[model samples]
Target: MGLAHVHWLLAGIDEIAAFRLVFRDDRTTDVRGTGRLVWHGRTLVWTPGGPYAHLRYTVAINRQRPPGTHFDSYATPDWIATRALHLFPEINVRFRTGVAAARARLRFRLPRGWHSATALAALPDGTYLVEEPGKRFDRPRGWLLLGRIARYRHTIAGLEVTVAVAPGSPLDVRGLFRLYGKTIPLLVGILGAPPPRLLIVSAPDPMWHGGLSGEDSFFVHGRIPIRSPDKTCSYLHELFHVWQPFHPSADGRWVSEGLAEYYSLALPYRAGRLSPQTFVRGLALFERYGRWGSDLTRTRVPAALNNSAPLVMHWLDHEIRRVTDGHRCLDDAVRSLAHEGGTLTTASFLRAINQAAGRDFTPLFRRHVYRGEPPPERAREDDAGVGH
Candidate 1:
């Protein structure tokens, strides 16, 4: 169980000289290759001695280190990082294989009492198929949990969702399920559909401050307080990613992250997850933070923390509502973007906004988003009836 072999098929290639096998700890194990193997830093560069269509290699697994460290490749007595160990090929390298898209399958040989939780669909033959469209064969994006884990399953909003928690985790699984039961339906009402399958993994790691979202899975730090405002916002933020896959651009980070932050609170408020006082407090907090800066177009982490981006989004939402006589809102613009598949850039977002509003929003975009002007102050009269 501590050793594994991998086989790869290369087609329409003149040379296999560019393939590199990445390993976390090369010193702990020896890799035997079918061809000449050279060590290039932490990777193994393999060059076939002759014209070959298939390559095979074996790795000796190291079980001493903790699982989920070192790029999430680990093998411990209780758990194993399945994807990292099975798919060791680095995608960033140039492979002259000329194969635009390649198919791959992984079969694991694990010890008894170990179970797996992954986004990959399992075939009838017990092999997991890796068939994510547009994903390179070398680098696959998904989660694979293998250990003596605790699993909770629930059908929410017509989607099969699974929650996997590591042993001895402090997370409140029941509370999370209840919260999701409330939140997922609201999200589906807004986005129109749920991901075919959703997987949530709660791992214990003091270093992981928040959560990370993948294609269909979410990873949250175990130390976060369960059902707290921060946890609720973080979970909804990642869930928003599942609904609308926003890619960060030079000037589009504000749209992606800001929208996520905005809806993380707004949707919950509309769904009754947050009280009026709490929701207004959240907006006030963002307003306070946003006063620190005005530039929303900068691609910096701190820029995302500024409240200006979300406030401007709030203004845009109000403007769209006002212009369309409450027939349209920001949700319409976001849904339009999701329908138009591709990387979401500032121009495309502006186009969506303009189409939704039925008028050009150039002046507003220039004054608020690109130029990062300070958000307009809320009048005292308006504040008097806050959250009503």
Candidate 2:
């Protein structure tokens, strides 16, 4: 084999706080993979050579790395390979001939905090191949994320993918998400397109932010401090915005933010990760925090929709659902706008809303979104569940 330099690859596994690489060559020459290392999960144990590998693993009870700090956590081989198999049952590997190749078979298991899988190899082209799976991808039946990066030395990938954990946190989905919150939305909004890449968080240091400049990849500064426990949904919310059409007039801000918020809870809710009660609690918090105080009353409102639109949009959703007897939701209005192929304005939005409501909601639109008037607070006590 050509003299091997350091290498990397993207693979998949259950979940983990960090990953450790162990490689053995044909000569059984063993080299424990180590570096500015950082950052896997699972319910079912993986079987060897049966499409997956299961290795003994453990969670980091308190492994939260500060915004700029660095730490290391290693995974057993069984854990790494098993997860990889599920992510790519039909694996298509492109390793350099004789330069370096990770062992094809391995085992992995779930221990505590999380379990993960990864592959490390150096290519002849001066690029490293790092593979991992169980990532987020919008592909049909390809939701399972997996890939390898062609990393170059002294570049973004050349820097170590540090391992980290947020201080005073558990492995709860929401908590783990919040650990990398604020930056994820901005990153997703900017980079979440085609050619998705793995995002490695080494330690919880705020200053470690770096990634590809293209409209497809993002690298979390693993060491950044967790700003709030509730910002966990920001990443998913921002990612969904990628599908929305850009509108200069309406800017799709209402639909984009509303849909983002809608899916933020919907996905987890559907997956049983969140309870309806808890979801409503989050909506309550959004209203109380009032991130955006858009005047719903003005027919022509001027404001970039972000965090604030969710609450008001939720209120609109409730009204629509109730008035339409659950026949239509905000989605219908947006779909109508999309099919019409026109920029959305106050008048156009109202037209869509009226079409979905099956009547002229001009008065309601005037009072609600444009006039910013209080919804029929007295009409139905159950309406109290809604907000604006």
Best by lDDT: 1
Looking at candidate 1, what is the lDDT of residue 19? 61
Where is model 2 more than 4 Å wrong at Cα? 1-228, 248-255, 291-304, 338-344, 373-388
The collision pairs in model 1 are 290-307
lDDT of 2 by residue, 192-309 (tens): 3212332332222222232111112222333332222443254355334433443426434455455566555544543455555566666555555543334532223323233345
Clashes of each: 1, 76
List TM-scores for all candidates, in order: 0.78, 0.41
lDDT tens per residue, model 1, 1-388 = 5455656655544433456667665532445545577887777777655545566666654433344443333445666443443445554344455545546676666679878777666689987777666556534446566788887889888878887877656777787777778888877755667777777776664324566677677766666764444313667777777667556667787788778777777776777767666766766667666644355767465544436677677778878887898899888888887777578778998999999999999898888876777556562113224634
Which ranges of candidate 1 are over 4 A from the true structure? Answer: 1-29, 36-77, 80-87, 92-102, 135-140, 189-193, 230-232, 377-388
lDDT of 2 at 17: 22
User: Ten consecutive residues with minimal summed lDDT in candidate 1?
Assistant: 379-388
The deviation in Å at residue 90 for candidate 2 is 39
